[model samples]
Target: MKIVLPTAGKGTRLRPHTHTKAKSLVHVAGKTVLEHIVSRLASLDADEYIFINDDENGPQVMAFMAEKFPQLNCWATVQQERLGPAHAVSLAAPRINKGDDVLVVFNDTIFVTDLDRIPQLCADCDGLIYSKEVEDYQRFGVNVVDDQGLIVDMVEKPDTPVSRLAQVGLYYLKDGRGFMDFLEKTIQAGETVKGEYYLPAVFMNMIRAGLKLKAPTIDAWLDCGKPETLLETNRYLLRDRHHVHGEATDTVLIEPVHIEKGAVVRNAILGPNVSVAAGSVITESIVRDSIINADSEVRAMILDGSIIGDSARLVGSARRMNIGDHSLVEMT
Candidate 1:
């Protein structure tokens, strides 16, 4: 099987941090978002890994992958234009062989699931889409399944939802060439929503051509596109994998917090959902539900639901903040 990852988005929602690094590189729970996604696929045997990225950060992503996953056959292509997901996947067509099973994942979302079952599920259908039952169906693209449990239609942000099964950012296609063909047709037809071709539109086209796609449920889907979602994802991850390996002298350590090696904490109350990266220092502060990046420092502050970037320094009495890398903010 081959893997296709679309990571070219500018991540305008994740501002200052996205300005310095790719959205996938944002740290949460001691790992990058891309690392979290790749870890989920660790059990699978992939022949090739293709990443569609923006021109600016494409090389950086490739470099990171090469360093971390050198054994895998990884390739990166720059998406010069901010076309769309479908167009991004199309860029990897040259590398994928016909009849090959392909796994497509979006980089901005993190999901926890038993990925080993995907092959078997895809074996039973023409394609598979991982979905979660979400209350806010209007906020996401959803799969309209019939009574038989087969996806009949794909609707993007429907005004009146036909189904509650919102499609997560994961997909599997048993026939790679067939999907490529449909994607090409979708691009050629110029049938775009908001002037951009969507991957679901191609799936809908395939369904119209008699392809059967199945929707499978997952354990959880966490999005990291916006500030609130990113912070929530941080909390979710830290809740599962939290430990203190660094010094915290005279500090009140709350349960479920991660203080990485080389971090120093003193006279602080660190929390139920917090992750302090390596070399960061927290002194005389109260932090909860926050992520303090590497080499950052927080002094005499009460921080909650915050995301401090690498090498940032925050001092004073701010309750919440989103400080970017190498920034200095002194509030009173």
Candidate 2:
């Protein structure tokens, strides 16, 4: 099966970090968001990997893929216009064969599931959409299933939700050509929410044409779109994967903290939930529930719920901050 990753979004919510690197490249729990997603799908034997990316960070993403996953067949295209998710997926059509099965996933969302089961679930259907039961269904697009347990329609952020199955950003289509046709038709129809075509709209169109879409449940759907969600994902990953390989002197070590190799810590109280990247230094400080990127330094300070970017320096006093890469901030 071919894999399609739509990673072209501007990621305006992620701000300064996104300014320097793609949102997928943001580090959390000792690895980039894209790395986390790729690691989870490493077991799946994908025929090709197609990435839809923006002009600014597209090259960087391709380079990262080349260095990390050189053995895989990877292709990337620049999405010149910020059309939307459906439009992004359409960019990969030229490279895909008509009869090929496609696995479409968004780059910013990480899901923990048995990806091998997706093809089996799509055996008797035109497509399979992964979903998780969410209490806040109004915040996301959802699948409206019929009495027969098949997806009848998809509603995006409904004012009054009819179902709790929130559509996670994972899709498996048995027929790539059929999906491309529906996507093109959806774009031609000019049917959009907020002037952008959504992938769910394409699925809805297919359902109207009598195509079967099966809904599969996932174990966990972790979103990294915003600051809070990113931190939550970091905490979730570090709970079991956290490790420390750095030097610490006169510091209080907390469980579930990941201090990467080359990091130096001294006279600090660090984490119930924290990740200190390689080459970073923390001295005479207290930190918790945050991510300190590579080569950054925190001195004589107390930080919580913060995201310090690469090569940043934070010193003096106690406070929470979101410092970007190569930045210097002193709290008086």
Candidate 3:
């Protein structure tokens, strides 16, 4: 089995940070989003990984991967056009073997689960999809399954959905043939909406054609789509702060905070939940429930529920900003 992970999107919503590194490189809980995915997938029977990146930061992603996960055989493919997820998977066709099982995971979704059991679970099934019970299905693709847990239909953001089971960003395919064919047909037939082909349509076609698909609800999942949601995800994952690194001198730290090495803190209150990356300095500051990336500085400020990027300087700044890496701002 292999895993196809797409990290090519422009990530316009996660500005500043995305401006420099791939969105998958965004750090959460002392690890990048893509790193979390690869680590989880590594525990499975996955033979190799296919990482799809864009022209913007493809080399950087490969460099990061080499430094971090040298044991895994990771192959990188460039996507000239930033199409939908289905299209992104199509680019992996040349690398993927026919009739081989492949797991397609979204780069931004930080899933916490026993992934080692997923390949075994899906081996007996034709395809497997993950779902979650959401209050509102209008914003996500909804899956309608039969009593036997076999998905019958999937409606993308249906106004009136039969089930609140929303599609999470995990999919197991027995073969990538149908997925690639679907993308080609959808694009050739000119059935695209808003200039992008959707992956749900492929699943819908497969379901209608009598292909068995299973939907297994996960225990915990986080969508790092927007700034607020990203912050929430970090807080939720920070339940254990033992692994977080930070040097404290007369500093008070609350539970669930990650202070990386080379970060110096003095007389500062850090975290009910927070992540301060390496080389960052925190002095006489109050940081709670936030993510501070590498090489950032915080002094004499109250930072709550914010995402501070690398090399960012915050002094007496209290404004809520989703800043990018290496940005400097001084507050009085």
Please state the error at residue 138 of candidate 1 in Å.
Answer: 1.2
In terms of lDDT, which candidate is stronger, 1 or 3?
Answer: 1
Candidate 1 per-residue lDDT over residues 1-332, each given as its tens digit: 98999999889999988898999999888788998999888888798899999988888899889888888888888888877889999998898887688899998899988988876877757988999999989998899898777898888888996888998989999998788889999999997878888888899889888989999999989999988999889888876676989999999988889899999999999998899989999999999999899999999998988999999999886467788999998853
Location of the lowest summed lDDT over 10 successive residues in candidate 1: 116-125
Residue 147, model 3, lDDT: 94
Model 3 lDDT tens row, 1-332: 77888888878888877888888889887778877777777667578789889988888889999999888888989988866777887788777767767789987788776766765767666788888889878998888988988898888888886888888889888766665665577667665657776778777777767678888887777877678878888888887655545688898888877878888888899888788888988898988888889898889889888899988998874467888999998863
Clashes of each: 0, 0, 3
Residue 53 error for model 2, in Å? 0.7
TM-score of 1: 0.93
Each prediction's whole-model lDDT (CA): 0.89, 0.89, 0.81
Q: Estimate the lDDT of model 3.
A: 0.81
Worst 10 residues of 2 by lDDT: 116-125
